[model samples]
Target chain A: METTTMIGQLPEVTYAGVIIKAIIILAVISAVAGFGTYVERKVLAFMQRRLGPMHVGPFGLLQIAADGIKLFTKEDIVPQHANRFIFMVAPVITAATAFIALAGVPVFPDFVIPQEVPLLGGIFVPSIASDVNVGILIVIGMMAAGLYGPLLAGMAQANKWGIIGAARTAIQFLSYEVVTGLSILAPIMIVGSLSFVEFNNYQGEHEVWLVFYQPVAFVLFLIAGFAETNRTPFDLLEHEAEIISGYATEYSGMRWGMFFIGEYANMITISVIASMVFLGGYNDLWIFPAALMIVLKIAFFFFLMLWVRASWPHIRPDQLMWLCWKVLMPIGVINMLITGIAVMLVLE
Target chain B: MENFLAQITTIEGFAFYLFSALTIVLFWITVMSKNVLYAMTALASGMVLISGFFFILGADFLGVVQLIVYVGAVMALYSFAMMFFDATRNIKENNTNSAIVFVLGGLSALALVLIFAAPIHNESIQALYPMHEGVGNAQDVGIILFTKYLIPFEVAAVMLLVAMIAGIILAGKKMDNSLTESMDEDVEDEIMKRKDLK
Candidate 1:
């Protein structure tokens, strides 16, 4: 009777459950990162009115697999003058930090495996790897630390272009991090919690998303998020036109692939955070389940990123810095202050 | 081996040992490495491991703050090290008075350790604020910081603002010096032209 009662209640988590969830997250996110490249190519091709990667598989679905094989089999080259250890470790650091940041993110709604399963029955898996109270802060902090990856990589390569790339990475990432933090501060103040779960719960309970109240913050965050992930328009760190692949000039084969994976993973993380904080996160709307809604929101954000990349021309480095320090940062701070006052007034 | 595995299976014990080991090793690497870049990298890792220790102690807010401030923001200083110095060149430490300095450093460290460990050894340690049930770590920190430590916090903020202003002034002075030097050169050139005409 007790066992049945326990089972009827919310499923309990075990060590095995955490491990399984982590593995699932790693595998699924990496696969999705690969698939994102295919989507980007197709989206850009459509914009340019050309077929992209049609020769690999059906509509180039297997292009990612082919690319993977090529990256793995291609000759791994280290420049003769490069700092060997740092050169090798840099790309791995980028990839590792990107995946580590995902730990705080709630990728899906919590679920339990049925009790009938052999040896691993009725295990609860929370949406987040660790439901840290400072989830958003940690995620952003880890992403910020990822700046060292490019900074070191560029400096280690013993190439003039790489050094320029590293310098750009430092300035770009540092300036935009302030914007990202301040923009998110307004929502954090309103919700009075940094946990993504609380953010989601607030939206659900209030029947309103934070974006409605903090529109300026949402816009600032979106712009800063694009720059943080080193996406187009603000991708000065690795701008091909100027720096010739930037910090990645000396990397080849799997090393280069790691940087690509890191970039895509970061893009996905930004989309997830945006949807959770600004959009109504993982909550049922109309007829759709919460899980499906979140996935749709994330997909839409990802597509938006690609659309913007295709449509917009890259900005000059000076313009990027000016926009970050002068325009977006001031807007973020003012937005945060307004939200704080409004929240205080409502409470009183 | 069985006991070790059992101890490690307990999350708290496992985390404590792991973070402690990482901190010690990384700290050594930071201090002893010949390459400045490697030392900076090791120092960053050490700082991160210290944050891990905070996490294990359930001070989540402090852990995240440490990460953001030390690992993220402070790294800008390390980036300057790369630009100002050629990383490929081996950094050789001067050995003058090395023995005397090492002895003094070791003695001070030992004294410091003894001073800290003496209290814990006596079993006289008391918790100032025993953690209460239903109070989150962040809330507790915020409450204490704003209420009890408000003045100190504000002072620290002011100090940081002053430091930022000082940095700006210092950088501005360098630029101003260059501009004045350029003007002096132009004036000297005009004087030489007048002398030649005479």
Candidate 2:
């Protein structure tokens, strides 16, 4: 039932390789998240028929660096009435959980370090940091735990707007989590494996993406992903027009930047998961290299997020809940049931 | 770098100690913190640390489920409900009888720990089946849960469903009472008009 023959053919796993991969993932993903903000600005600007961030370097390429510097140098302010300890810890939780969720995600294909390297020679790096068998479940769990950051931050700040924002954050996150889990259940049932690598391998072998098999699940997952990341339309938690900056109203400087980093990191994580589960993952398509193909897919999802944000207006809080419980969740459950029956019938 | 990697390669007693220490500290904070919100946050962190323990034990399925159910869903709901109350008020533990009860509770807990420790020290427990070589973390758990523990699992699921329905009914009852209270004021006004005519 379980085949390790394929994994056995791969390079050996080593502690050095795992550590190196972790560092690489952290640094590269962080940089990409910064770059994502720039891309978002550019995309939104193009959509709006205006130039965006032209001052910093060529076509505002260095704007992220400038923003980083500004955020670092800006004054860190704690509101007079706020719970200082929890307030300070809140953003860190958001940022940490977001990155931790990436631990289960396979950002790129595995590679072996050359023996020619001086200190760390002949080490094999797996695509994911920790390739736990329950990879998708752990990732989803970590992401869900991230809700505490905004929820606690908003309430601790002692601002009326912050409380309102926190309330919305709690409801929005909890409601959509159901949709995300149920939507992904069908694909998990189809593959009979929760590990992303297995899902990728299944698709690679069958030459058919799970999305082609379960299109409804794919759409539901995508919509739920948007809500989970608190992207536009579903981003009522921090909608500037409604609740000022929402949970981040009182946050300043690097603290505020942490929230943005967490958001972008989560966006990347969702894209990676979607591509791995629904798209062909790191599997080669046509003449494209597997590694490059996955990156391209992730990039497309990220761009789609920014494009949707620019094009659509934010939904009301009630509407967001209505959509989650009444619309998406029911469809997701039905999809899962159908997929389960189909799988059983095929097996029989 | 090689030394660092080598150090991490072995899961030493130090890692266990570290996680245990973290769990204890967070649990203490959860119990002792005056602010309810802080206590709740500490509780959530403690739950995550307990999940860490489960992960160390190679129960990946249980650990992830612990995070999802306890730390993620339950704690989020707790904090959401907590927001409706005033956090500024420091809950005063002024009851003398409560202090006596606390001491008794502490003694009982100590006694219970000692009782459990003796058996653990004496007994050498072995797994019914070796868990190291398995199909997958989730699959292994699913197999046992659906086969050996099927009845218990079904009972738990049914219990959860009943609890969910009860919660909804309770909330509905509150809403109905509020609506009736508003209508009652109008009914009282009509009765007063009749009394004036009499």
Candidate 3:
């Protein structure tokens, strides 16, 4: 079946190549996620007129390494009343789902390893690990599944704050999921394919970013993405002021670090999706190459998320729910309906 | 073991067996576990594993929908509700009628077997929407859903809408009243305030 499926593809990607690519994605994304925290701290500090982590090493360039060492060396602690098994499993769920979601997202353009690269030479590595036809949906699905990490972590810890965090996690993630799906439906309808590659190619071929056509969707997706990732203005899940770090109150050492990594990874995933789906993906600009273009777009989104985080204040839970169900969801549905009619007219 | 392993040549075959085995084990744990939290977690994971079966069969759209709908939304809601209850404690089950339970279980098992076996033996049973060549699985499913099975699809949508409305009405019947506060005191205060205003 695998062979049959790959018969007509432009390049026949090998299993070995996919495995290698998956490994590369895992290592690179994990490293990038760690680096993201450093960048976020630096950016947030700059915004607040503070010099953050300058004493660590060269303006805190090696702060990631320092943090990594600290996390690794710190004692793993579980609350006395916590469910030990689920507590241990929760962070893995978060980290694993975050990485798995990246499987369907194209981080880079497809390229073949040169013949001189020894054993891995002449291998064709596709942009995505698995470019299943329903790529976007599956990526979204995996991210939605990532809610379990926080939900389970908070519930298992047996702390009041953790339970509150878990409760917030449930409502926040579930509510935004509707907005995310509905908002993205416009672009999916326009492109007529769920594959990120297809969305990229469609924009490239038309010489127009999807954001230009579906600006409302682009904005809605960004807001929902922020909430889904539990960023500021919607970071009620772990709102320190009210709940004392929310679901992560009982987590210590690398378990807590795993949640942090998962969050940063999810941020990157959302940035990548926004870039690919709305901002013309990895397509080459007039002066820039495809690779450089995609990196810049993704970087802008990552910085934008941090910028929003630095600037915005958190919303109340009731307000968040009201904004989602009564505001964003309705707008998304209307936008999708309009886009459907427009597409039908154009096609006809 | 070697022969069984050798029979699984494709990645799909290997994944099928792996997911099926894990799904069964997880579901078994879900059913047998005394703790509500543990049961819920196992059930959620089992749902996720079930999506693997769909993916293995090349039904990518169904796999994703299963993930999004079941594991992502439904199970998360289940866990959310589990928060209100003391989920960590073991649930003690009192089986009052083992004989009736066994008979009902056996009957359901027999019905399930018959339902599955019918497809194998029946020659006249045809798929309503045959898989279209050169079309993606998602597009194929969409075409069938919007065309041949449109009525059934609309009916299902309507059913879901009705269920959602009913759920809202049932859950929101006493939204204005605080469960923690005394209703009689509030009512008496309101009556006194009204009398004073008059």
- In candidate 3, what are the lDDT values of residues B1-198, reduced to their tens digit? 787778576677788888989999999999889888789889999999999988877788899999999999999888888989765567888988989988999899899989899888778987767777667888998888899899999999999999999998998899777564767788889999999999
Ranking by lDDT: 3, 2, 1
Task: Give candidate 2's whole-model lDDT.
Answer: 0.88
TM-score of chain B of 2: 0.76
Q: What TM-score, over all chains together, does every model reach?
A: 0.92, 0.91, 0.93
User: Cα lDDT for residue A41, model 2?
Assistant: 94
- Arranged by DockQ, best first: 3, 2, 1
lDDT per residue as tens, model 1, A208-326: 98899888989999999999999998999999999999999988999999999999999999999999999999889989988799999999999999999999999999799889978
Candidate 2 residue pairs in backbone clash: none
lDDT of each: 0.87, 0.88, 0.90
DockQ of each: 0.37, 0.45, 0.66
Alpha-carbon runs more than 4 Å astray in model 3? A1-10, B1-6, B121-128, B170-198
- Candidate number of the best lDDT: 3
DockQ of candidate 2? 0.45
Docking class of 1: acceptable
**Winner by DockQ:** 3
Model 3 has a DockQ score of 0.66
